[model samples]
Target: MKTSGLDVAPVNLTHGPACATCNGPTRLTGIEPHPMRPRTDLQTFQCLVCDGVQTAVVSLVH
Candidate 1:
């Protein structure tokens, strides 16, 4: 079997019960980028209920 991208580390998914802004029952899915670029690494998440965008420094480990 071929495992190029498949071998790559997986992005962590965190669930947020409430929206940070509205405090509503919403979830935030965070994906940590590859650790090569720590500073550039960002956490991107979208609210399933409100469609809100939240970003943070999740971290990376090469």
Candidate 2:
């Protein structure tokens, strides 16, 4: 979709996880608190090269 005119390219995720589709870099797009877990979050990411989206669960218990 729409960005703030800021480029998402060159913004790689920490540890540099590759996109499953294009094997390109991904950037974190969004994060939200998990409904069922107070110490967890749902993270959304988008591939910079292919524009593919991915979601993941992150725990905040550390």
Candidate 3:
């Protein structure tokens, strides 16, 4: 599905500790607002291993 130029798809992530700095798996915290879609926020995840962060823009369609 799609909405307002945002594509709705399964947001999956695969990550692991690349080094000793990173401990374990990553975790999702909250959503962030997009520049175009002020009402929408993208899903954000943080890596436990390397403290790396990732964001996935998702469309909330009802």
Query: In model 2, which regions exceed 4 Å deviation?
Result: 1-16
Candidate 1 matches the true fold with a TM-score of 0.44
**Model 2 poorest 10 in a row by lDDT:** 7-16
Predicted structure with the largest TM-score when compared to the true one: 2
Ranking by TM-score: 2, 3, 1
**Alpha carbon deviation, residue 59, candidate 2 (Å):** 0.3
The residue-by-residue lDDT of candidate 3 on 1-62, one tens digit each, is 64687565654455422323455676666666777985567877787666777676766655
Between candidates 1 and 3, the one scoring higher on lDDT is: 3
Question: What is the Å distance of residue 29 in model 1 from its true position?
Answer: 7.3
What does the lDDT read for residue 38 in candidate 3? 53
The predictions' CA RMSDs to the true structure, in order, are 4.9, 8.6, 7.3
lDDT of 1 at 46: 72
* Candidate lDDT (C-alpha), each: 0.59, 0.77, 0.62
Q: What TM-score, computed on C-alpha atoms, does each candidate reach?
A: 0.44, 0.68, 0.49
